[model samples]
Target: MEMEKAREALMVEEEASELVSRLDVRPHRAGRDASFYEGFALRGIRVDHIQPGLLTCSFKVPPRLTDSSGNLSPGAIANLVDEVGSAALHADGHHMKVSVDMSISYMSTAKVEDELEIISRVLGHKGGYSGTYVLLSNKTTGQIVAEGRHSLFGKLKSKI
Candidate 1:
């Protein structure tokens, strides 16, 4: 049943990617302002979908972001996973969310040339805390490279 849910989530992400491609607006973190992903050049990490508690993101792994093993660096994967998971909390609407805790487990290695799909869903949200689950997979093989759980604290930001 978990596998089925994951598969369904992937399908949703694919569709959302197509739709997002048509949008005129880009994410606030798409460029140099993306300090969280500064270690590696994050080409693009798009929020594919956000429905209620679910969120999905697609990413491209650049060769320059690899390690000596010719695989994507664990640090890079961890950063991406955290960004995607936190971004899920904001989705296309909510904002001013900060990650308070992030735990990642690497299951496998992903080659630098691999395109990755990251799917995140809110497990629970209450008061000031939000819990999220994220899965990172190689797009071609559907092999999961890493999974993460994040706890977020959110507050409304005052507009200047």
Candidate 2:
């Protein structure tokens, strides 16, 4: 009986894998509603400064973004880096760029209520490709929490 059950489970798993393998990706549509992740990551974030090719922001580490042990979650930090780093590229006038590569270095942990200073600066741009660097540091303790480099690419809109 146990062997029969195991065989049935294996078949089910194989079928699931086959279904997933058949799926294909499509380009994102513009009118879709904003995702839950957007709301979760945007809360409590304030733009402290902005200029051509640069962005600086402030955020208080909220409990909702913390791990079980009370430190800020790494995924949340990565999301912040992605968003802010992309925002820094807006000076180039390409509003629809997609991240093609990202590298992040985590240096320290931040706790709930810790104010974090986020700075993003453009590294360079060529045609539709761009690069940027981001830094996240604790405001009070002045400790760097993470640093990231992001590369993005997008097609320019044709003017009719």
Candidate 3:
């Protein structure tokens, strides 16, 4: 039974990867660099607006991301928090950073096919550590689904 489940999971992952490849909606970065958060593209998350110290993204909750109870899973919410939060670091001229800690508060649940807006902002930076805050909100109904805080520590890469 476990082996069967693993095989099924692998098959689902392959299918999602194929769909991502066909979508042609990945974020465009110079030199065609592979984003560290490639799974975001696979899951149909798109950067709606980005600027220094802030990033706004939109996503549709796909059925595959839901728990058996038909609501978005905690893991999926956490993934969004982390990915969106990391993107905010770029606003501070950081090319990369390693997560040091993270926390999330789940305020509400999102159902499959629901549209969500994720807003992330750089809160502070000191001594090679940066803090970010992210909020997930329902686009249509304007309800907050989750909020997250992330701390990261790493060297900020030089732009030039």
Best by TM-score: 2
Worst 10-residue stretch by lDDT in candidate 1? 31-40
Worst lDDT 10-window in candidate 2: 22-31
**How well does model 3 score by local distance difference test?**
0.87
Residue 85 displacement in candidate 2 (angstroms)? 0.5
lDDT of 2 by residue, 17-116 (tens): 8966875434545568444555566778899999888999999999988998999999899889889999888854557699999999999999999999
Model 3 misplacement above 4 A: 1-42, 157-160
For residues 43-82, could you state the per-residue lDDT of candidate 1 as single tens digits?
6776677776678778777876788889988888877867
lDDT of 3 by residue, 1-160 (tens): 9999989877757776787788545675966765645644345998999999999999999887898899999999988888889988886578688889999999999999999999999999998899999999999999999999999998666557
- Give lDDT: candidate 2, residue 89: 83
Best of the two (1, 3) by lDDT: 3
1 or 3, greater by TM-score: 3
- List where candidate 2 sits over 4 angstroms from the true fold: 1-35, 158-160
Sort all candidates by TM-score, best to worst.
Answer: 2, 3, 1
Per-model TM values vs. the true structure: 0.68, 0.76, 0.73
